[model samples]
Each structure stands twice: as structure tokens, then as C-alpha cells.
Target chain A: MFLPGRRLSLVLGTALAVGAFAWFFASGERNIPDTEGGLDGNGQAGVFAAAAGAALVSGLVLSSLTNALRLPGKPLEIGLDGLNGATYLQALSGLVAEVSRSWRRQIQQYFSG
Target chain B: MAVLVSDYFIPAIFALVLFSLWFAGRDRVEREAHQRAVGISMTALGIANLAVQVINSVYFRPRPFVQYELDLLFYRPTDSSFPANPAALTFAIATGVWGGNRRVGAALYALAVLYGLSRVYAGVFYPSDILAGAAIGVVVALLVSKLFLLLEPLPTIVLRLARRLYLA
Candidate 1:
């Protein structure tokens, strides 16, 4: 429901996808302790935070990628459960248009009155 | 695999799975329901951690690596080992999500079980410790969910405010 435009989703998703793997590899290589007492409480917290971030990033990337890779020639119809970037953009654009029209009408009425 | 999973992989995946539930559902109503579940799970996780800490303070149990001769795959944790914190945290989240979304909750439960097993395999936690942790997590989640229900409109009001900010 909080989907962004296709282009934005693609870019962000790709970045997040790369970031997730990169973080896992980099952190695993450096922070995983081979010796006892190597990881303190703060270090453990950092690892957990990094893991959470990576996971969230990966999930978002997958969701956005799934929607982006849909057939390009197909109609941009919002499905009943279409909770992707495109649908979010569609809804956002609709909201903006509605708000602008209402504002324009209000202004026009104020001037006439 | 045990080392990597025990260290961070499972927790990472668990967070991913839990958050995915928030993005699920066909409409706002469905999404809101999932969001509520996420909120409850997160809250339960926090409380579960606190509960584990309290237990640790009350009773000190040495880690498996300290007492038994086994190839340890994880770092030596300084905390008390009577209740596995990872197991408890994961189970709390799984149980919390289960009340609203069963499928995702089931996946979370599987992951939680895997996490617990990996910790044991890695020579960090005892099977009994993991069991105790899981029990603590499940009981806390159930209690917290019940409390939320008893609180009624308060939780709903908070969610409404979150919705106003486009959070829910």
C-alpha cells in the first residue's frame, strides 16, 4: 500500500538488494568471533541491528523486484491485493490530483465571493 | 552454517519475515490488521528480552562451551545461559504474529525452531535452555496479546494515530 513509483522502487530495491548481501558478507567476515570474549554486549547489539537492517532491505528488494518484473505490455490495473510500488504510485497520484482540484475549486469560490 | 546462522543469519531472516507481514494483505483494513500484529510482536519481543534478563539476574547458568568439551561454533557469551535469549526473542515474535496472521506466524515459528536448534548445534545453548526460552517467549506473547485485548480502544487509538502518519 505504501508502494512508490516503478522507477523509484527499482532503484531503491536494487540498492537495498545489493546492500543486504554486501552487509552480510562484510559483517560476517569481520565481526563474527572465532575466539571467546571477542564479542561484547555492544558488539552483539550492532550485529543484531545489522542483521535486521539487511533482512528488511532484502525483503523490500524482493517485493519491489517482483512487481517491477511483471509484463511491461500488460495493463496497469490495480489488483485486489496489489500492494506494490506501482499501485502505491497510482494511489498517490490520484490523491494529489484530487487534492489539487479541491484546492482550485476553493480558490475559485473565494475569488468569486 | 551453524556458525553463520547462530551469529546473525537467522535473526536477520526472522526480522525480514516478521516485517513482510506488515506489507501483506489486500487492502487498508488487512494491512492495518497485519501492522497491529507486528506492533504486538515487537512489544512482546521487548518484554520477553526483559523477562530473560530478569531470569538471568536471578539464576546464573554457565554456557555449554564452558562446561562440556565440544567444538564451539559461536563466541562465548558472558550472559547467563539458563534461558537462551535468541530462542525466546524469536518465539515471542512468532507467537505474537501468529494471532493475526497464521501463515507468516508459522514461518516465523519454523525459523524460531531452527534458530534454537542452531544455537544448540553451535555449542552455545543447551536444549533445555532453548526449551525454557521458547516457553517464556510463548507465555509472554500470549499474555501481552491478552493484555492488549483487554486494553481495548487504547491500542486502536494508537494505531489510528499511526495511520494518520501513514505508518500503519
Candidate 2:
């Protein structure tokens, strides 16, 4: 079984996404909003939302194809599920549960004592 | 932003994507099963986000601070900020992590805050939009994550189909 802290791929993913976003800004490429919008066909919100939607669709389609090819094999698949990612929610949940457990134990001890 | 440093769109989206990646990356289950779970969960989130976007296009709304010239950290998009689809997508990814992967959820939550604050700062999106989007995303993620687990029997059926089709 892979150790929780041993996972580095998730950290990489977080870094990549953040780096990409920052790069977009730091690159300083002036985004001249194309007046002639394509899919959105209206304003800034439409365009941004459309872009986000496109990203989602494209990512899904690509992921399916990757799966068919077994690109990541089993390890990669786990990573994609969002469960394998080395995030802090697990620790927090553990901490919360631990606190509750400890609190309960304390109360039980008090009553027993 | 009128909200805070954490209330931005870019940071939120970034957090979402990263959290999803991180959560899905930490499976203790069999590799193939884990992979399939991640793939399905991500695809669901992606589709939900996309579908919501299309709906938004048809149902256009306005931004919160569009009327006033405000100093901000990011560029604002012109669209109805209600039902923040991006936030919803992130939340879905976060819930999918659940007990199976906590790191991913934390990352996603962090990203949610960033995305929400960024939108407000950019002078696009109302608090309502961010709230709705985040709530929806969380609900969807929870539902879809369980759905993936339920589909455990699918791989066998799919394999049988592949054999019949001679694609195996």
C-alpha cells in the first residue's frame, strides 16, 4: 500500500495547475478580447464560462481515451479519481474524528470515574 | 476584491483542479479499480461543469461590480455570476475524495476559496453566484463519487462486450 505522505504526483498536479494560471498572468500577454466571440457569442462571462466548459469537456474526452489505452495503468487511474491526490482534507477529517473520539473518551472516562 | 485575498476566481479554479488531481491520486484500492474510479469521477465533474456553462450561456446574468470602476487583481468576465459552475465542479471533485483521499479535498476547498474571491475581485460574479456554484459542486461531487463506486460491476460487463466485439 502506498503511504499517504509518499504520494508526490498529487503535489505535482497542484503545482502545475497553479503554475499554469500564474504563467498566464506573468506572461503578460495582453488578452485582447476577440469582439467576434465564437461559442459564447455575447460577453466576458460567456466567454470565460465557455472556455471553462470546453476545458471540462476536453479533459473528460481525453481521459476516456487515455483509459481505453491504459495510459496510466492502475496507479494513474487512482490519481485521477481525486481520492489519491495528496490533499489535506484527509488529515483534517482524521483530526476532526480524532478530536471527537478523544472528547468522547474523556466524557466516558469522567462518567466512569 | 470586496471579499478578500482568498475570494478570487483563478485561485479557486486552480484549487479545484489541483484538489481533484490530488484526491484521485491517493487510492489504496486495486490500481485498475482506482483508475476507473478516478476516470469516472473526473469525467462526471467535467461534464457537469460544461453542461452548466452551456446553461449559463442561454440564461445570461450580470456581474456584481460591473457598474463601478473598481481596482482589482484580475480581469472580470461578463456573464451571470450566479450558479458558479466552476465552483460546483471543484466541490464535486472534493467530495469524491471523501475518506478515501483527504489531501485532495483540502486542496479543492482551498481552490474554491481562491476562485470565489478572484471572481469577486475581478468585479465579476456576485456572492450568490459563488455560493450557489460551490454548493452545487459539493452536492454533485458527493453524489457522483458514490455513483462511481456503484458502477463497480460495469468493468466486467464492459470486458464481456469487448470480447464479443473482438476488440479484446
TM-score of each: 0.69, 0.50
Model 1 per-residue lDDT tens digits across residues A1-113:
12447567557755775598568666645344535445543366566668666865565456445555452322233332333324333433554676799999999999999
By DockQ, who's the top model here? 1
lDDT of each: 0.72, 0.52
Task: Point out the worst 10-residue segment of candidate 2 chain B by lDDT.
Answer: B159-168
Worst 10 residues of 1 chain A by lDDT: A71-80
Could you tell me the lDDT of residue B142 within candidate 2?
Answer: 65
Error of 2 at A45 (Å): 17
* Candidate 1 backbone collisions, by pair: none
lDDT of 2 by residue, A8-105 (tens): 74576557677966775556543433433322212433445566657655644554444433332222221224323322233234445767999999
* Error of model 2, residue B111, in angstroms: 1.6
lDDT of 1 at A22: 69
Docking class of 1: incorrect
Candidate 1 has a TM-score of 0.69
True contacts kept of each: 0.08, 0.03
| lDDT digits (tens) for residues B3-118 of candidate 1 | 35555566666666665566567677777778888878888888998899899999999998899899877666777898988888889999989988888889889989988888
- DockQ, Cα level, model 1: 0.15
